[model samples]
Target: MSEKTSASRRAFLRTGLAGGLAAGGAALAAGAARADDPLITDLEAQPWTQYLGDGVDAAPYGLPSEHEAHVVRRNVAWLTADPVSSVNFTPLHELEGIITPNGLCFERHHGGVAQIAPSEWRLMINGLVERQLVFTLGDIMRFPRVTRAHFLECAANSGMEWRGAQLNGVQYTHGMIHNVMYTGVPLRHLLEEAGLKGSAQWLLPEGGDAAGMTRSLPLEKALDDCLIATHMNGERLRPEQGYPARLVVPGWEGNMWVKWIRRIEVGDRPWHHREETSKYTDLMADGTARRFTWEMDVKSVVTNPSPQAPITHGHGPTVLSGIAWSGRGAIREVHVTTDGGINWHQARIEGPSLDKSMHRFVYEFDWDGAPLLVQSRAVDSAGFVQPTKNALRKVRGVNSIYHNNGIQTWAISSEGEAENVEIS
Candidate 1:
């Protein structure tokens, strides 16, 4: 063979051998990557897998796992002067299901949480009644108890966004709300026992807090679904949630629920209290305010892919989850939009759609590595549909700080990051 032909043959063999080695190396690397996920993919024993967990009575009152420490109620320091008489938002982004945990529920107090001993507490029912009555905690428990789930929302929830999308996560904007099962006696039976006068038009519920929170509740609502609750989520009410007893006014603002309830006075008209006229009232641009806006409208928020809970995995099958609720009635349906409201598809409503309670929803789809503008709209049994921010502003004006139940938008980038945004 010629020298040039021999050299060419040798070079060709070397090139082919290097290429084969490269391919084998890539395969070995891929196998190692798969092997690294034994904690999730493999059935091998791990630290927890090999050992036994704590026994039954380890903790008489159990707590959540240590992994969930970040899931907590947070207060915006600038929103109020002090933590005691201020507000703290629920960590809605980390929560799931319809019922909110007792400890994680939002906290709002005008004077601070009251620390009243249940043994010393007394409930007074007076004014416009055939006979005034005082009942102790034990007396309250004996009055034909009932249990039901309901959502309690502050009328000022999302109030900061009236002018613009001021907050990032749903916990900051819409976390001033919570849903839980309450155990108590109906206010109707109690009012009937007291023999309400025909002339009584309203009931003034007062709390024992230093601020002495008070509100005028219509007689119709008092006889409908109002509850003087002492237990929440199958446990005794937390002190922050008005321990001992609080009025659970279903379908009304949280402020009207009257934590640490002390007295009930039957009256003929609204007392025009500070909370009703100066605080919770919606002030419009034209100077006229919408007063007594008690019931929260239909509202929904995408929880999983929010600012705090962003998409982390590569584009593929993605499950979009959220929560929807209304004060008027049960949620009938929820529609999700991923194209800035240009198109919408019905999301799967999960759990029991109870009256005046939160409903869980989920929408699943394969992502195509494209930017998304996501939003959710809820429809209540009363046929009331959630409105857009622009549509709500048109009716109530931007000056209104309370009752801002407009639809929210979360913009997701192609890289799987999410942010709060306003879409035209």
Candidate 2:
């Protein structure tokens, strides 16, 4: 090598062997420590492996790594009166790719987990239906089935933050959500089988679980791409995630998913159930409640560089990746900010960019060993931009819990750790 080139290489190692740093740290360290160290010329390396003798031989079904054992579905200690009425949040900060494992899907029951046997399960259509029909699990399956991926998010997500970022981590502020592919017969198919009468304008879906959770859906939505899903992420549903069956309301809040789904009643008007009336209403600053706020607005948050997940790897070229989505339509833009949301930069989104599905985006930048306030913004195909915390609070007061999809920010320390914060 030329003398200047050799000198520059030595300087680069002195500062930090950054690129492929996770793999090249030792290579550079060896050169500075010992002259006889072998150079690492090969660009590729073998993945770490544990032979059969290392652990259990096998399982009827596989699971995530034990290293991921810390990841779990969490519940707010005092959100509700009991478990059935409480909410369990998905560990969004801990996940990477889409497709939440069925076991990890967040649970929010009005009563408690239901013990329903598929043999006894029956879905009945009544009320304004031209032909009232009750179908067994097998009968429902006899019809055609379709598989699609979608995200289920509780409207109350980040609600605690409205009062002033009460929660410390994204796991708490933004974990009441999950994205998974469902395999099941579409709700439209079942509705068609029942044959809705001309008078039918609304539908109420009830769950079989102890709480008997229920919600009213507009007839237009009932027949539009809804699914009575029996499987999540390519497997039978988990007990906590609505075993046997659950409703999948695409581009809508999770509460409407109606886990342990059991019955559908066609109606002429909204049933105005407790969930739609007193619970899900978004009380505004003037004391007026914005009821029936079903569509979750476009929201985005930096998953990593947050309280639970920190930038453990310091300096050099770092990848800032996060999740973004819109209920109105497909996400069109997701901006990132190294210095909070003051000046934003476009992120490089990777993976599938489907309509009404989660889109993963990444931003690469050089970390200069300084404190940073990282944030993300999502814009939908409808040209609607995600609202700021203040903008949302200006309308919906801090007392409200549902339909708050404000942009979230993460503060990164010089030590490389991250914490959730609000940045104007």
Candidate 3:
């Protein structure tokens, strides 16, 4: 590479870092040389250690680098009167590799984080059950267990965008969603143990948190794939994440995943609680509301090329990557757009793209840096292509939040800085 080009690439690295690209520049620089270049090449020319610090010097539990301190879950202080009733956003700009760390997953609580003990914690299953059973945490352990990685998304995520782009980064706009591996007993095992009666069709699950969140769920889902998880990513649950126990309602809104779960009452009808009724309802532009909208529509976002992450490679084989997901099933396709919505190229999906799970996708491109716009559209196993923000606005009419699965665009300048912007 010429000195001028090398200088330019270094400048791009700094520009991209400040703009918020999740992948570290130094790591990229270390391995920048193309493979099969020359067997006699000296690796000392690289910036990072070929094999970083050993054992204890490295994290016992891995963590993002110290340079990534700005990446964190943040909540708007005034979103609620107190922190107890607030929401925190996951640092989408600072995360990579799909699985969000257990400690940094966003939190939304109506009543502060609950402190519950597994010893004293007991789940009562009653209502339409053949025999009302109150089972302690120990009783739950007796049932067979299953493991899976699923994303939990709060329904009210991106609520601030109704009046245009109120928040700056994707962290606030799309951080409400997080993917994690969980180990727990399936909901079916518990319901089977309680012996659901023939009339049992729905369940009213209640949480032990101060919020006392409760929601009615179909028996079909309860028996299908839901889990009662106590561990995330092989560690004890964090206090803010409902430590002792939490109901894992797969592919559904987070509100229904009752945290610090305490009771399950099988019922015949949906119990319209404060969360399901008054709060989560979507106010449409037609002056009507969309209620009981539980299924999170298939959605995808380009995490890089946003304010938190920007193109720092200056026009070489730049790797563009992002995450795609669907509540319906596995992501079948992820299309990338570099020219706003005018043109799009399908990204190569990599890693485990499981059903109802987060799928990481990447597209390599040479960027000229001339003003650019980027977005990612996901097509799920159901063949549902993620819609653009304008398309969503045309139908939903930018009225409210509940399911804003619209494709988001990131505007990039010649200098490589990026910011959130919406385009047709």
Q: Which is the leading candidate under TM-score?
A: 1
Question: Pairing residues by index, what is the TM-score of model 3?
Answer: 0.86
Quote the positional error of residue 50 for candidate 1 in Å.
3.7
Q: What tens digits encode model 1's per-residue C-alpha lDDT throughout 116-138?
A: 99998999999999999999999
Query: What lDDT tens digits, residue by residue, belong to model 2 across residues 1-424?
Result: 5798547535533322343355455555655665432334333332233222435657546777886776888888798887757888877777776667677777777778888899988888888877898999899779899998888888888888887766656778888888888898989999888888898999999998777888999989878889999988888877777778889899998889998888999999998998888888888778888888898889988887676666656677788878988888888999998887679999977888877788888898999989998889899999999988888888767878777788787778886656566765
Better of 2 and 3 by TM-score: 2
Sort all candidates by lDDT, best to worst. Answer: 1, 3, 2
Model 1: lDDT equals 0.89
Q: Model 2, poorest ten-residue lDDT window?
A: 43-52
Q: Which candidate achieves the best lDDT against the true structure? A: 1
- Which candidate, 1 or 3, would have the higher TM-score against the true structure? 1
TM-score for each model: 0.90, 0.88, 0.86
Ranking by TM-score: 1, 2, 3
- What is candidate 3's lDDT per residue for 59-136, written digit by digit as tens? 766787777776678887877788878889988777778798987899988898888777888889889877789998
Where is the poorest 10-residue window by lDDT in model 1? 8-17
Model 3, which residues run further than 4 Å from truth? 1-65
Q: Which of the two candidates, 2 or 3, achieves a greater lDDT against the reference?
A: 3
